[model samples]
Target: MSTTIEYVRFESTDPTELAAHRDGLVSLLRERYGADFLGAHLARSEDGSFLDFLLWTSPEAAARAAREMPGDPGAAGFFGLIGEVHDMRHAEVLHSTQV
Candidate 1:
């Protein structure tokens, strides 16, 4: 069984600094997650409210990665954007026949 994990996060203040930080961070994720990664980036307005989605190889791995996100200067200010960071939701697909 393959597990797919998804997450939705909201930011109150969309500072350009935050945008720059996340942009760099996502690029790093590509290198790390690779083939198991699925990217969905959304920006609703200029004020900086946005949502990002990701699909991971396994729900467990996703959860772990989120917790242990690479600590870098760009990541340092990430949590400041939101008053709360919700836990990522996930599901298991026994058979995903793509046809």
Candidate 2:
């Protein structure tokens, strides 16, 4: 199955607090999704917004997480820190490489 890249772009009032939740969020995803949850990355833009990327084994897995994560009690703290979500979407990875 092809991998899916889920990206969420948002603005947060407190980047530090939002960053602090990274490990917890990742742990929760790993616990819930296991190997299907490949990895995650968080980046800050020059405009002060943030971009979050989550890699999943498939689109189904990505969609499942999107459907379930919001209702997950463990994600509340991380979700609460986001002031606004500009965009969220998933794209199929055509190619990837490690060097």
Candidate 3:
């Protein structure tokens, strides 16, 4: 099965706040979505922008989670930490290498 990937970008001037947001979102994803939420990779740019590569089992599953997240009480604390999503896109993984 092809995995769905979400490419996202957000900007934050405060590194500490950004880290906290990232952690909270990751924890929420894991706790709420479980195995359907594959995981995420985060990176910091020189200008303090953040890029998040979120992996999911499928596009449909990802969409459902996204749709419900806003109404989930557990997700409330994570909502504000996301900052401004400068860009967001979904893709099917073509290839990958893991150690």
Candidate 4:
């Protein structure tokens, strides 16, 4: 199966609040997605925007997880902290190189 990557970009004014929300989301990812959740990473831009990268086993798995995220009780606060979603998309990894 090919790996699917979830690329999300959002803007936040409060870094502290964003950190807390990121932690909560990570916890939820582990608790809810478990093995299906390959990995996650959070990054910030010079303009203060945030980017979240999530990897899953497949596109279907990623889609399912996203569809159910808003329904997760723990996600309420996290979602609230995300002030604005600049962009969100999923794509298949066609190639990769490891050293």
Segments in model 2 whose C-alpha atoms lie over 4 Å from true places: none
Taking all chains together, each candidate's TM-score versus the true structure is 0.60, 0.96, 0.79, 0.88
lDDT per residue for candidate 2 within 1-99, as digits (tens), equals 889999999999988888898889999999999999999999999999999999999999999999999778899888889888999999999999989
Which candidate achieves the best TM-score against the true structure?
Answer: 2
Tens-place lDDT per residue, model 4, 15-50, is: 787777877888888888888888888899888899
**If the candidates were sorted by their TM-score against the true structure, best first, what order would they fall in?**
2, 4, 3, 1
Error of 3 at 72 (Å): 4.0
Question: Lowest summed-lDDT stretch of 10 residues in model 2?
Answer: 70-79
Q: For residues 1-99, what per-residue lDDT tens digits would candidate 1 score against the true structure? A: 366646665664555666667766677677766766665454544544555566677777676667666354455666455544433456665655547
Clashes of each: 1, 0, 0, 0
lDDT of 3 by residue, 11-93 (tens): 75566765676677788889888999998898887777788788999998778776887577766665556667798778998
Candidate 3 — which residues are off by over 4 angstroms?
70-73
lDDT, each prediction: 0.60, 0.94, 0.78, 0.86
Cα distance off (Å), candidate 1, residue 5: 3.1
**Candidate 2 overall lDDT versus native:** 0.94
Which is better, 3 or 4, measured by TM-score? 4
Q: Best lDDT goes to which candidate?
A: 2
Query: Where does model 1 exceed 4 Å of error?
Result: 1-3, 43-49, 70-74, 92-99
